[model samples]
Target: MEKFKTKIAIVSSLTAVMILAGTASAYAAVPAASKGQATEISAGAKADKKTASPEEQVYNLVTKLQPGEMIAYYIPDKKINLTDRILFSGKGYVLTDYDAYTAKAAQMNAPSLEIPETYPKDYKFKSGVLYLKEPDESSELYKKLDKQLRAEAAKGGKEFYTIPVEDGTGEASGAALTFVKGSVEISLYASHVKPPKPMEGTPVPFSNPDEKTETMVIGGIKCTYTTAPKLKSRLSWTDTSGSVNYSIFADNAKADVLRFAKAIIEPEAK
Candidate 1:
């Protein structure tokens, strides 16, 4: 079971990294008072009606967010393990059959984002992971999040937390489509929410010098393509509407990955 989970984690991480980079706006809707040990939570709260600082502006957006919205936030100087973080919540589904997989995705309450119905002939749909469900209180992940959040909160002052307090409350948060050809795994993540404007200290994604990045228009949709050492090459883009977002990752050539994204955004062209 551990081995199976490890494989799923490997497949899910690529998509997760992209999601974290893009779902900033969804964070605007989350409340600071919910979950974890941080009670002095007003990092984004109002400051006497003066102009909102970038962080405060970000904090204000959380109050207006609807339930089940696909959201992601940044918590600086985190000491907890990345594996322990509750990225999002809701029931999880892992299915291998293509028809069943797309069927399950269609039923999720996430924004009406597209799921590809086509892929390279040799690459078979291996599995689809919808959400990384919150760990149970008795689980090791839960214990780590609890201990770490408390430790961080103990330091005093407003705590921007790495471990989200809100989980399993809204509709399912996100979905991941995974395919396999021999030993290689490819992943696609899609959602309707757009990334929020950055807070004062928000870090940029793909900042490493070894990470090469570019933007190109595919089928009239602008996409960001990135290649990093020891990591899969990935292409990310929001739909022309700028509402729905997507990112596809593969070890294949950039042209092949572009073909995959084209298959998704322009299914007829495929």
Candidate 2:
């Protein structure tokens, strides 16, 4: 199972193209470190030594990464001038303000998304970010990004899985809400549409073979609760009645996790 997951992770890293789009003014200010810096292509990469699209820039940087080297970016609240020559930050548009985060979700048309009215008292809302898939096939950047991914896969002697690039229409189809208390954190992910399947393989199941999983109905919703040694507990369910999918994660969470799921489910049930 670990080997299988490693294979999937490798292929996914090669193919996953996260393109973040939305109004920057919708969030807060970008940190100085990530603000408006143009991405520098590595000397080993074959990218043209000229201006490139934000997507292309990110593709070059990500493909050039070694095992341990890394880069991170933050979005500031303001209008993003994509046409302007600047390095796009990381793949996600993170919003620190609750109102801005929810506003972004609404903009993404996640009307079916519901938030729990209450959670563990010690946990405080941290931030939220939208998740974007690869760029649309119709996009020119898609051609370049796909080429880079295929080239990277060949360099590693791996099969390149070409995920069908859907016309996302520039709207994020999913988002995650995060809450934190000291060292512990929880994440809740939501999406209206069913997730697309991998082009060539079965979808990876959330439960690992080493994990203990429980299937139960809570607050009229059937949920799968999973736990593994030294791993965060996870609870996931599809509210078929409401047409919304949800998952929650946290450390050593069991009863509190169920209570949290119930908190979100009960509100919708009412």
Candidate 3:
């Protein structure tokens, strides 16, 4: 109930954080990457990236959004004509029921973040990203949660992020940006706060695989990280104890993880 206090995430999650890495990349995943060659993939279709595959293009558009912007994004996989805009209540830029499409999905005309394709799902580009899962602004619990998260992000010293999807809430203890050989994952809170549960997908419970955990100091906190010898994907560095002000979740090789950990300490402290 309390751990969800973190307001934001670092812009480094690969399949996740990479979306937040750049504003243009996150919101306009398609043409945002190519810049100039934004010819419609089909007649009257949303823009596509000239340099990337369709999936990479979609991923870029959905992930490039900022913390305050809101839109329901979907691929034109099923229907050719798609809705691209909506009407908002103005408070928190919340989306209302109206959307703009033959589907009648009239959004508030706040610059929409929609993409389309011809028979998109008729082929391999079968997935879409939805943005309709925000916590109700009218709900009392959500209001309290929002207040708590905003306050916690303020503690990071440097400008940090807030939850993009509605799930976790708690005061952010601290934040970290970790890297593996081919991937990088960044966290905004140090403590063992189960992040907000996504509207979709089953939430995986977190646990330290090590019987004896180790600590690497970062972001002004002594973070506890460990590895699951059997589950290579389980390699992680995080702080479950609420003792330190903050820390990082480093899932990298031990040597590099520790080295980077030491380097980030003083700057995060400031």
Candidate 4:
């Protein structure tokens, strides 16, 4: 059983790495579209040769993702571990773990605005900040869960968060949402200020030599970041046999550190 647990951890870790690598490659090739940039509907329509709803367009994009590769369309305010039923296209899909992919997407998609402070100001001790322009709010689905979310926030230590709903475009046609997940609850933080920087002497939780961390320059600003596999025990379980562990961590500046922490600790779905 111990051996089996070890094998599971190893395989899960490798799978996560592969998925992340693939996602990174795909993102690099097709840079995130500018928010409210019409989603290239005409081009997309021509490509698909059919008119599809926005969700369908997103679904098409998701289908392009390789197995183990998931896309995040929202950014959570705080770090959280989410174990709820993810309703995708009226189907209930469980997100066993959370990834920093959505936060990364936000950073990639966000326009280069001037940095307000030298240090990251919007930094959460737990999760990373996801910045979205005001005006992109209006989700029938989210409205359904708002009350439950408020209740969870009232009970939270370090739980889940939702990015303030807003219209991504000035026209108020779309809504922006953030999702943070892991072993704990997820929270949402929204701010007009710049994100805070990593404090000096602050211990970084994950680091890898073979997996070198890199810096991303957005709008002429360089953000320091890294990715590494770290052992997570919170999401583990012990039977009569023994215990099993997981691999998760902070991989980028825009990543939800808290969610990454939870992912590292949470068990992978069998």
Residues forming the 10-long window of minimal summed lDDT in candidate 2: 81-90
lDDT tens digits, residue span 1-270, model 1: 244234334323334433332232443444555554443334432446544332343333333444333223333424422333333221244555656656756666644434455666676765565543334456665666667655774575542444454443333345667766787777777655534433345566746789888988777777899999898888998766667667888886676677678887775333
lDDT of 4 by residue, 62-127 (tens): 434332222223212322112232112110111222245333434335321111223223432232
If both were scored by lDDT, which would come out higher, candidate 1 or candidate 2?
A: 1
Give the runs in model 3 whose Cα sits over 4 Å from its true position: 1-15, 22-26, 29-67, 70-212, 215-222, 229-252, 263-270
How big is the RMSD of model 2? 11.6
Model 4 alpha-carbon drift over 4 Å, by segment: 1-23, 26-28, 31-53, 59-270
Candidate 2 lDDT, 116-141, residue by residue in tens: 66766777877776654334445675
TM-score for predicted model 1 compared with the true structure: 0.52
Q: What TM-score would every model get versus the actual structure?
A: 0.52, 0.56, 0.29, 0.19
Ranking by TM-score: 2, 1, 3, 4
Stretches of candidate 1 off by over 4 Å are: 1-91, 111-118, 132-167, 195-206, 268-270
**Distance from true position, residue 164, model 4, in Å?**
15
Q: How close is candidate 2 to the true structure, as a TM-score?
A: 0.56
